[model samples]
Target chain A: MHEYSVVRSLLRQVQEIARSNGGGAIETIRLAIGEFSGVECTLVELAFRDLAPEKIGRQAKLEIQNIPLEAKCENCQQNIIITNYQFCCPRCNSQQVRITAGDELTIIDIELREVGVNA
Target chain B: MNQTITVNRDLKADLKEQANRFRQRMSDQGTLVVNLVSSPGAGKTSLLQRTATKIGDEYRLAVLVGDLATDRDAERLKPYVPVQQLTTGGACHLEIPLVESGYERLNQSDLDILFIENVGNLVCPASHDLGEYLRVTLLSVTEGDDKPGKYPKMFRTSQAMVITKSDLLPYVPFDVSSAVEDARRIQPELDFLTTSSQTLAGVDEWCEFLVRQLRKIQK
Candidate 1:
């Protein structure tokens, strides 16, 4: 699936972050995946399991947080959590709504062992 | 010591930035890039054939068709316009790099429109931005009307939905109004067009829409 490629990209970003911070051994990689981001979390974990060994070591664990779609209605000016993938505003039933959050695959943080530190 | 680093970065940010820059460059060059996405056999090639027949004389059009193996799509469109086929080998979707390389292969300037016909998969293609000014998703009548609700991300990310094979409506159970309603719930502002590439029905409106989009960017 495309999750393999996505994980590849994620690991590359993680590798950069780890390298910039003293090139530590990655322990945990936390990700925030929105419901509408077109990514499957389980597939991402599966891909990471298969690919992470060489990139971030075998012991590295993945932690993914599911984010609900959030949008702001332009006409009603109400913040709403979208359900059933509906993009309309709930309060005023206005179709003029803009997505404010929950549509991205974001790397929130990473836990790693410091390069010179003992295990 | 175990150290926690706060990165808070989107994985696709760099790729998206590159795509944005590419889109800006295309806009500056007066080329309207349209990314056509759909499931396999959803009439993307058929629609392109009709579009070329309808508007080829008026606009300079070229196409970059992505598929897993064959250059068949490119071959099909060559009679009407300049075309390049991107064979992904095993990749399910087209990325920015492939698109850029395809454009380079085309090597044509003074183009009015450049259509990137993405690999035929609804799920994966929606996640990748390929530097297009417009993203149009196609759904044929045979795919059923519930597709939009099931594939929310694909419908949500698209700017327009083209219901292809409209001539098959009588025999199929697909309802056009219900399909549009389902998609609109997810997209809210998505433009809708129905076309039967076989009979060339609604192809004129599709070309007109492209013309309007071109004018908008040119201004």
Candidate 2:
């Protein structure tokens, strides 16, 4: 699947952020992938488990957070969270809506152990 | 000791920012780059072949085709217009870096249009922008009518959808209207055209739409 490539980009971004923050050995990689983003989660986890680079993040744990698809109801004037791929407003039953979230693929944070600090 | 750092980074946003820069450069030169996506054997190449023939006299058209192997698509389109192929080795989708390199290889000036036939995929390519001003996603009639609802990401992001192989509608159970309606539900503003390159069914209307869009963008 394309999750392998997505993981490569994620790993590259994680390395850059880790490098800026003292270049320590990483322990955890926190990420957020949206439901509407078209990325399969299980495949991403599989890729991370197999492909996380040894030098920078051999022991890093992958934590992927799911972001539900949320839309702004123009008629209801409120934010409605969608669970079943429906874009209609849950409260007002209006079809006119704009997506607010659940289309993001971002690395939120990381936890790292300083080189030789624990051992 | 473990240090927790809250460094939020939007990776797709970063790629899109770069894609926007590439798109802007093409816009500056009055060229429209359209990223075409579809499942394999969904008539992307045939549609382009028809498009090149119908409008080849009116515009200087060139195509860059991406596939995992072989320059076959490029060769297929060579009889019509300028063609370049980007062999991705094994990647499912063509990303910005490969697209940038392919664009350089085309090496034309003042061209009226450029078409990028993305690696034959409906899912992964939905995430990669490739610096296109417009995206046209194709769903062949044989692929079934409910694909739009099943795979909404491609339909959601695409500005237009082509129901290809309309000639097979007589033999297949694909409900053209239902497919169009499904796509419209995902993208209310999406334009739909039913086409069969074999019969030249809707090629003119498709080409006309492209010309209209090109004119609108140029003005």
Best-matching candidate per DockQ: 1
Best by TM-score: 1
Write out the backbone clash pairs for model 2: none
CAPRI category for model 1: high
Could you give candidate 1's per-residue lDDT for residues B13-95 as a string of tens digits? Answer: 98899899999999999999999999999999999999998899989999999999989999999998899999999999999
Q: Each prediction's interface RMSD? A: 1.4, 1.4
TM-score of chain B of each: 0.97, 0.97
Could you give the C-alpha RMSD of every candidate to the true structure, in order shown?
Answer: 1.3, 1.6
The local distance difference test score of model 1 is 0.92
How many Å off is the CA of B68 in candidate 1?
1.4
Where is model 1 chain B poorest over a 10-residue stretch in terms of lDDT? B102-111
Off by over 4 Å in 2: A53-57
Highest lDDT scorer: 1
lDDT of 2: 0.87
